[model samples]
Target: MNSIGLLIEFNDGRVKEANFGMATAARGENRNLVALVADGPAEDAQAVLEAYGVARIVNIRSGNRSWDPARQAAAVAAAMQKLEIDSLIGLTSPSGRELLPRIAARLGAPLIMDCIDIDLEAHRVRTSQYSGKTIATIALTGSHFIYGMRANVVPALKEPAEAEIIDFSFDGYQDTGYEVIETRTDGSGAHYLAEADIIISGGRGLKRAENFKLLFDCARHMNASVGASRVAVDNGWVPYAMQVGQTGVKVNPKVYMAVGISGSVQHFAGMKTARMIIAINTDENAAIMANCDYFAVGDLFEILPELEKALAAAKRSKEVA
Candidate 1:
């Protein structure tokens, strides 16, 4: 069986739960599962990675570099060569957008991004196309291939295995020439959008910026992230970071709840990979209604508040129990 490598991501010294799904995707009966980790303590992730079938953890040294994608990619590629990894899988996030392609290009390997399914034995993978309207099956011929999967769509079922950590230093890897100045944040706490399992989005149907509270309130109660359509952002009802469309962030969450959104192809393009989509619109003939798994034709003002109240009541009941 071929060796499978999963690029594990960490946040502030902790493992990102999203990588478990990537592990699950790469798992096979006779395959060897290796985790490629950097920046964070790989030991901290041993238990969780083993729970999802990782067999080994390769901890790579960063060489005191400060936020360089080129350096990071070089280290990852070097690790792959050292481990003799035949295939690699990772989650599609901000870092992946830069790292995965570079690694693939450096290794001269075939690469697929935002994939929903992969069959390593067949050298084929499945991804969404035409704004999530259909699935495209792509075949590849290569000695090694890297796949970037959408978050939460693949179930990370537990199949335990013990993991051994291997310390590797890739100091020979130098930067490929991309440099950054500095980074800033507005503290919006919206970074989870790219990795969220559940998201609730609003559009022009929301009417006003203050009215976004309706969506935010529901999202908070449900532990779901909030998103906005291009229309909503253009109208100044929400920031561009919250926008979901062809021009906005592409998301593939488990459950996407679109409220007051008029289901345009551009917007659906961003969330077409969602496992389940529920739309709310006043028009029965709205484009969103046709594309959604389920929909309710009603005034969002009434439905949103009612949903929030019901969610709050449910949470209270669970707490009491």
Candidate 2:
């Protein structure tokens, strides 16, 4: 069997539980190993890896909340070399993108990033490209395949096992001279677009920035995060953080409510993975309506308030119950 290694992150210890889901897909016909990169939440990392049936857990300590990607890359590359790993899987966060490439380069391996699906047949691993919009499956010809997995795309599995913890230290690991000058957490406790369960998006039809309060009201009622089309974000109706599309964040929310969006293909690139989509727009022929699970054909200016009232009433009744 091939051996696969997972580079783990412990953020507030909450994400340690997430590793089991990630490891499960790679474990069939593969020996699973997890390396816990200690920044925060180390204990959580140990628990998650053990639950995932990891054969070994390597722990490395770093004191900084903002970890250096290059250092992480070097550490992972060294571990891969030492263990003779056949395949390596990392999470597709900003840090993962930065680290995995360098690690792949060090190992002389082929690197695939943001892979939504993977097929391991014999010695070949096949992957789809262009974020699932356009399909091109390629098989790896190299001895080792390195990849970054999109969060929640793979089903996590749980197996009972005792995780063997091992400590590993990197000596003379030079800092890449990049220091985090400042840091501020979002405090919302919501994950980014790629990880959100529900997304409420606005678009060009919203007309003005001040009108976006209506969008926010609807999102609050639905208990969802806010997102925007590129046009809306460029128009300054919403913050750049809320933008969703090719130029913005990619989201796979369970329910995506798009208000006033015309849905350009670039915008669709970001949200096409949503489980259920609802569009509110006057244009029945809008591209968004075509892909939506349900569409309300009407002027959003007239429809938003009614929806907000109905959602509010439902919330009130639930609270009463």
Candidate 3:
């Protein structure tokens, strides 16, 4: 059996939910699942990784500098080499996007990013191309492979196993001149769309930028991230960072609620992977209506207030309970 390495990502010291999805994707008939935790407490992730059938965990210690992507990549590459792992899998998150390519470069292996499906034994994978217009299947021609999966697309399933932990420290690491002196948040105090489990997006139908507050208010109660369509961003209703489309951020939330969006192909390409899609638009003939699992036809100006009130009431009820 070929050993498949899963690069684990942690948020606030807990295993990110998406790692389990990567773990699930790495499991196969002739694969031995291994988890790699760099600069984090591997023990903290053991129980969950075991639940996902990860039999081995490697805790790589290079230093306490979590922001050093080069150092982390070196450590991970060394561990994979020492373990003789055939393939390395990780989420196509911001950090993963930064680190995985470095590791692949160091190892001289082929790497594929934003992959939706992987067949390790066959050395083939599938990914979306041309803004979700086509699905492309690619075959790897290297001895080692690296895959960066889109977050939240693969479902995490339970497959219990007794895990064995190994601690690895790399002493041959050298600085690459790049230093992350300080990290700061954008101060929005909201999750990025890629990492958010629930996302509510606005579009041109909102009429103006201030109208987005309606989405923000509802999102606040639901603990969801807010996004915008290209039209909304182009109209200056929101910043480009909040845009979700082919030209913006891709999201794979559990629930994607599109408000006022016309369901253009570009916007759909970004969020089509969401497990559930709900659209609210005044036009019943909107393109989103046909693609969404559920849709409501009405004025969002009226619907948002009632929805916010309902969500707030539900929160109060749950708190009291």
Best by lDDT: 3
Stretches off by above 4 angstroms in model 3 are 315-321
Evaluation by TM-score, superior candidate among 1 and 2: 1
> Candidate 3's error at 277, in angstroms?
2.5
lDDT of 3 at 24: 89
- For model 3, residues 132-222, the per-residue Cα lDDT tens digits are 8889999998878999998877888999999999999888888778787888988776576897899999999999989999999999999
RMSD of 2: 2.9
Model 2 per-residue lDDT tens digits across residues 1-321: 566777776555566434555687777754656654544454556665677777777665443446666666777677666667768777776567687888888778887776666665443434334644775555666877887777677667788667777665656467778766776767866446666677888999999999888977977877778889999989988788888988788776778989999988888888887889999999999998888899999999999999889999999999999
RMSD of 1: 1.8
lDDT of 1 by residue, 91-123 (tens): 888888888998898889999888888898898
Deviating ranges (above 4 Å) for candidate 2:
16-18, 62-65, 120-132, 175-177, 184-190, 221-223, 309-321
Output the TM-score of candidate 3: 0.92
lDDT (Cα) of model 2: 0.74
TM-score of every model versus the real structure: 0.94, 0.86, 0.92
- Candidate 2, position 128, lDDT: 38
Query: What TM-score quantifies how close candidate 2 is to the native fold?
Result: 0.86
